[model samples]
Target: MKHSGSILIVDDNPDILIAARLLLKQHYQRVKTTDNPFDIAGIINEQRNSDQPIDVILLDMNFSQDSISGKEGFYWLKKIIEQDANIVVLLMTAYGDIQLAVDAIKAGASDFIAKPWQNEQLLGAVAAAFSHAKDKQQVGKLTRQKQGLNQALNTPNFKFLGQSNAMQQVFSTIEKAAQTDANILITGESGTGKELTAHAIHQASMRHNQTFMSLDMGAVAQNLFESELFGHKKGAFTDAKADRIGKFELAQGGSLFLDELGNLPLEHQAKLLAALQNRQVTPIGGSKTIDIDIRLICATNDNLEQAVAEGRFRQDLLYRINTVEIRLPALREHSDDIPLLADYYLNHFAQKYKRNLTITTHDMASLCHYSWPGNVRELAHAIERAVILSEGENLDVSSVVGNITSNANSTNNPIENNNAYDTFDLDILEQRTVRAALTHYQGNVSHAAKALGLTRGAMYRRLEKYGL
Candidate 1:
């Protein structure tokens, strides 16, 4: 018959405290009784400090013999609410004090019970109060979660642009997949707007207003993978300073976008697959497994089929993620969209840098003609560079396409050429590019990584590999 919550009873009569405590103790997990209503503040403070806060308070009116106004009860009721607005309060009054009890209820009391109350009525009232308190706590938790999500989504860059037939087909697929909870896997070359596609799906889904959290696998080190995805309790590890909520928990009741999925280690695939299969995750160094509800969307540039064949990736994990697959065409395949994309980038950069710049027909022709091996990302970077370096209102095509054409013509490999490296050796070119990016950003790893189209963790590994 015991309920889940604790209760506190305050009365001026010792007999009333003894009778109330004995009756309530049979139903509540913990029952505290006090004969002095003046000691209420101290008792509440002690409970608060102990972290075993009182859930409901049963306060009696008319503490003094001549006190029929119930002023003392009203004052204590206000004080209790001030101490903890969430705590449920029930005022106890005599039959003659019913009017005063009604006034107390109007002020702030959760409910009022006559002094000669039936046992069933008292139990039901206290149970209802306890339920109300729990509901308040849950609402507060969700409000904080929503605020955190809003702060995380402040980086407004979710534009999905492309009018080509391939892009049209991709959009069609996204529209169909957005209504359901099926797992989606987006496959495409780097900078082909895979993350943008994921965002589009999330926005179009029913959970659009909930949350859309993106986690880049390439940016997470292997050592910290479990903790990053499944969360960890305080003291779980040497560096776990506090209990942390993982991406799975944060994205609950919404969508979770796992970018660079191919970068996930083979050993960790089983762990991810298990969580997806069971719909639950266990935090590091924690025994409890928390249930999770989320729509999964994964993106990867790597050919997962080839990886599976080569034993570098698990086929089971791929099956779990690719229930619905969307493939994006590279920039070269959709060269017709170059003008639209170029104009978009031009306007974006112009607004960003607070400059007025126009793109000429000649510049458009040059951009369309070049085979963008780095895809849309490289083109955006080129436009940003032109916006920053150009002196006139018109964009400088020479500066924009000069090094691009030169590099493409100099190298035999188109991929290497698009990288803008003069050297033929790929390793030395990679090392040099990483070093240059780091230098350009003045040792800011995140900026350098973004400019180079690499994750921060990947850039760190490259820096260590080249001793930069």
Candidate 2:
């Protein structure tokens, strides 16, 4: 097999440098030998700029003719790590200096090789070091992502709003659970603020200063599930052109919210369960298993118990994720909070549209009396639409409740409104909803898809089917 990585060798002995370069070049893609250790940093910077950075460095322990202290080797090793902690360094030492080699390992050297080492042993050590370097690179990348996500979480938005008894209970539960590292499972209908609940928990937790990563399990395809959640190395499979840091690693020392957990395929549930149980993940085409430390928070609309009983979900996985369950009540169940939620959305959208609009008592009552099947999300959307389309200081009650009241009086189902759909055909309903989302977002496919909770690829397929 042809190994694919750049290797660097640094030694004072010309013979050792030549021999090491020749042997490594036969296995690795690129090999460079340097007799001076001071030039190491310059070479690495050049290679990094050229996008061919060395993956592993082989360094001799001694430089001066009669010196056996290995001090120079330790100094250069520290330099290499300081320059790029992702680059793995293997220290070369005499058999008599084995203790020094151990010290080098403790000082961050990947491994060590004694003089007169067998060729097979040298090659094995180099291969392992290369793998270590790649893993470190992935970790570094994840650390950067964690930093970026922390910045994003600092933005002011998405407050959890409610004063009802049901919502008060949810707030109390979140306050209690936020201090612990226990796994949490949030159950609620779609758009009922399950993800918001998860976000609130993360922001309140001891890890609030760390990263908060979220994934919608339902959006990922079955074939990409493992790679998306557990990560994959370069060349792990077709089209895996580069190394990827998965959600579990990115959210290390923080919280990871797995939404739509019930939609995860049954066949793939075992893999997820295994990772959670082991608290480690092995990337595809990688030999090293990485330990993960994360507070997992999962949300699902489906009744997991029913899914487990029907064999659609793994019982073991459900038990693992639901260590402490918090269920959010649907909007209809807590209708008393409708006026507060509606006014909040009204003020939010009014400001967004730069409109000095207000909601009349009649319109507010109309919003509260309607049974919002789509929960808080639908209410928000309706208020936004009213704010945009209203021509006066008062929001148009007709525009806010036209479809809802008409459909409710006819069939007791607000979703069956003529604007969204006149019939009960699922395809037509989907088409209308997709069209409406596209319109709402001004034809931005990504925003439309996200608003509908569909992946961009899925949204594109629907658009093509409907010829939109």
Candidate 3:
């Protein structure tokens, strides 16, 4: 396998340099040789500035005749580390001794190798050094990211926002689950605060002090899936100009939240399964597999069981991610909390917009009575808009409820389902028709799909999409 690793060979003998370069180039993507050790810094600096930093250096211990002490190798090793602490330096010499090897290691050299090294031994040593270099680079990044994340956690925006019986059960589950290392799967409709729940779990876990990295599976493109989850070396792709850590590594000793998990393609699902099972990831264009430690949490609105039955999602991957599944009740199911949720958003938006606003007693019913098809998220947006238009007056119920009704994309309103079927909102109408067909067939998905002129897969997708 071709490795996306850069190796620099420094030696006074051109023959040693030539042999090393020829062997290394076959395995490594970039291999450069120089007979002069003085040019080491210049070459390293140039490459680092160009975003292709050298990962490993093969340095000869004796550049001058009768130089058996290996002092020159130690000097260069120290200098190389000073320039880039992540670079792994391997010292080689024809004068082999245990004391010299120990000194080389103490001086920060990765390994001490004798000249005329076996091909297998040389390859094994370089590969190990390259992997060590990558790990060092990633650890540096992880430190910065951890600091940033700690600062962010001090002022979080997502909140657990309900006290209804259904929600109280969810809260109780979270309380118990948060104390364990079990992989969690959170299932809910759009805008139902799935991510917020995941965040809550992270905060309550023992790993709360570390990072909580979130990756939106739906938003990530297919080509960049591996890089996003498993990192990439510089020059791995056109846009990869520098070594980059992935969500898994950044979330070391913490949690990784994979949002919209159902949207991940089947092929990528297999790749993810492999990584999850192995507890390691081989980065794109890099042969070395990095061990990962993260508490996995996946959230999705789609019914994964349906997808799995239809062969759209992998069953084994499902078993890996959902050690414990938490299904959040929809907003309509917990209508008792609507007024509380509405008041919270109203006060929040009013404070944010610097407005003196309150929901009128008469108008509060509209918020409680209507089905929040878009759930809490859509409610927050509606309240924010109403606050903007309140003009320091009472919030207009029309401004909030009217906006939700006019949004034909709101498919979960049972009240609207009873309408004259006269509206031109095709999305709503399609959802209604699908539900009607299911009801008529007593939930026979095949018959419902046949009546709607949809394939079974298409029917399953719609059911999952509409959360039927």
In what order do the candidates fall by lDDT, top score first? 3, 2, 1
State the lDDT of candidate 1 residue by residue for 154-200, as single tens digits. 23473688899878999999999999999999988766788889888
On lDDT, the stronger of 1 and 3 is: 3
TM-score of each: 0.63, 0.60, 0.59
Per-residue lDDT for 1-468 in model 2, tens only?
A: 668789999988889888887888788888998999999999999999999998999988888888788888889999898988889999997734657867988999989899878999999999999889889889989888866779587333656899999999999999999999999999876568888898899989998878888998877888899898889999999989999988999888989999988778877899999999999999888999999999999998777898888888999999999888999988888999998998888888888889988878867777777766557876777777778878978988567547453344555342444443447768657755875676565444555778999887887677655444
Model 3 stretches with alpha carbons more than 4 Å out: 1-148, 151-155, 403-468
Q: Write the per-residue lDDT of candidate 3 for residues 182-237, one digit (tens) a residue.
A: 99999977667888899889988888878888998877989999999999999999
CA RMSD of all predictions: 13.0, 12.1, 13.3
The global Cα lDDT (0 to 1) of model 2 is 0.83
In candidate 2, stretches whose alpha carbon ends up further than 4 angstroms from where it belongs are 1-151, 154-157, 403-468
